[model samples]
Target chain A: MADFATIGQQFVQFYYNTFDVDRKNLAGLYRDNSMLTFESAAVAGTAGIIEKLVSLPFQKVEHRVDTLDAQPSSEAGGILVLVTGALKVDEEQKPMSYTQVFQLNPDGAGSYYIFNDIFKIIYSAA
Target chain B: MADFATIGQQFVQFYYNTFDVDRKNLAGLYRDNSMLTFESAAVAGTAGIIEKLVSLPFQKVEHRVDTLDAQPSSEAGGILVLVTGALKVDEEQKPMSYTQVFQLNPDGAGSYYIFNDIFKIIYSAA
Candidate 1:
């Protein structure tokens, strides 16, 4: 599953890079019907997704991914990726840890776009 | 918040209960378009989902949920729930741990149905 691993790592890297610099560039990663859940709020469409990212309280943010697992789906050309990471926003607030899952649908050869994304800040389960 | 917590707990209990005895009863929880990811396989439609469950090698299975976190979604009637648990298939095989996430969309007043679910076995990150 090198393809899965490579594509997963590449997509994660591209996502965080774009999220840090040109949030707008991330638009192409989603379709009009894509669903993104930030915290608990669900946003739909490319415009809404971009707006949600750009409107984050922190202007400068960085994500450090700890664990990334990708699995090909039974659905034609679909992939499931799970990411666990910590996000540092600006320099003041404490870094927040998160777990995110994404369902990707193939857009083209070796290319996939996010179809469903669920992101949550990890509050201790204990 | 209470509503979310209550519904989350109730659903989890109801799910495991039905999963143990009458697996068919779980059918009402899903729609034709609902997506359930079992390991890396994605199954759609209620019939497909039920088939996947019953086809499991284990006949008598039990699930013990450890963490159940629920958040209300921005969607008018959607709820996002994350579950971490352990499952024992039978007397012979060792227990398997798992993490599952579910997106529930409102079906009727105070009623919801699973729209998307992702389930994975934990093999350890370290």
Candidate 2:
């Protein structure tokens, strides 16, 4: 049921939804084994990923994903999207720049998985 | 003529091929405007890509792409591969660890273009 066009829209919402923490909504987007390998941390499963979002110290975190190209292999039951964008992290004063890649499993429901995701974060000097 | 399986195989060969500079061979992989948005460098076109490869200061650099899942949309003429791996860089003494995502163009002849590529570079403690 999930096609690349549908998958692409979800991706945009997924990244931009960080504008405000929607725990319940966000949780629905991932699979049980939705591994999140961040630049500084790698967390496995939905529980682990939940912990990171709940424990983040930042007052505000903004992630913008632009220039997206997605490929959803209906036969393979998975999808991949490449996003050229930036992430603005506050409180810790991190660089808000990045080019990101997200791999998703658009499965029937919650069992979907994120096999891999790669992002380049750029930081500014004080 | 290129399928996901074929594209996947080429992906591995492409990354590993970087171990040694193969400009002519590498040149055949991308489209005319194959934009490369590296962690630190952004090069566009075959000429630009070639120029970057020809001017690297490092004596040795290694890129390892593992755990690949590729989707080639024969209907779309584009293939996207999600790779979980690391990059080892020398001379600059930086972190070689990373999880990368590559968007490739497996077009006819040399007509393919990379829409986007994102990589995370992990640096070691000094």
Candidate 3:
């Protein structure tokens, strides 16, 4: 059995680190079949996902994760991770609330690749 | 092949409708192996999930979905559905933003059940 808690923690750390520093390097974490839903747009495949991430409006961004939850999703050892966090973009004074989910599939080896990712920025209800 | 978009739309509609009207009836959509992460708390199994949900602070709530995204997650025909919406609890004047992810596993009988669910309420960053 896999230690999903540790895996989820490590993945969250690595993902935010890479996303904040070098987003292009995050491509290796995805495969050709991967899909990313950013806000209302859905992008498919590694190239598209990376392109979308790299093309975000902000030049600099940081993610501060508040909660992380993981669950074994499939009989094939897929992991579902949910994260609620705050994101600071550019020179923004206050961080924006965001929620993201990642579906990770074991690559038959000791590693895993992202199968699906969805991210959304939560606007204030007021 | 499963029509993930249609399935996601129908599932979201049914889920929120059941949740707003009679949350106890939503138990049929989950199984023993199901897990739900509400905010920072993790609840497992149908009974626990229902208890946690029914015990929420609000007397009445309504969800208005803003975006819905779905991706085929596994070879086993699981679907990953992500929803960004707003929730009005009781007599609150402003609806709070919320994001929820649901992993639906296809049962052998042409139906699907919730394998994992995570919900979060987004607070104002300002």
Point out where model 3 deviates above 4 Å.
none
Checking candidate 1 for backbone clashes, the offending pairs are none
Instruction: Report the CAPRI category for model 1.
Output: incorrect
Q: On residues B28-80, what C-alpha lDDT tens digit does candidate 2 reach at each position?
A: 55555565655546677777776776676665666655445554433445555
Interface RMSD of each: 6.4, 9.0, 1.7
Off by more than 4 A, model 2: A23-25, A91-95, A109-115, A123-126, B1-20, B24-100, B103-126
Could you report the DockQ of all the candidates, in the order they appear?
0.10, 0.11, 0.73
Report the alpha-carbon TM-score of model 1 versus the true structure.
Answer: 0.57
Residue A69 miss distance in model 2 (angstroms) = 1.9
User: Clashes in model 2: which pairs?
Assistant: B31-B112, B95-B122, B95-B123
lDDT of each: 0.74, 0.56, 0.89
Q: What is the TM-score of each candidate against the true structure?
A: 0.57, 0.50, 0.93
In model 1, which regions exceed 4 Å deviation? A1-126
True contacts kept of each: 0.00, 0.09, 0.87
Q: Residue-wise lDDT of candidate 1 within A1-126, one digit each (tens)? A: 357657878888888788878777899999887878787677888899989978877778778777666655424556567776677778745666666777677776657888777776654322
What DockQ does candidate 3 have relative to the true complex? 0.73
DockQ of 2: 0.11
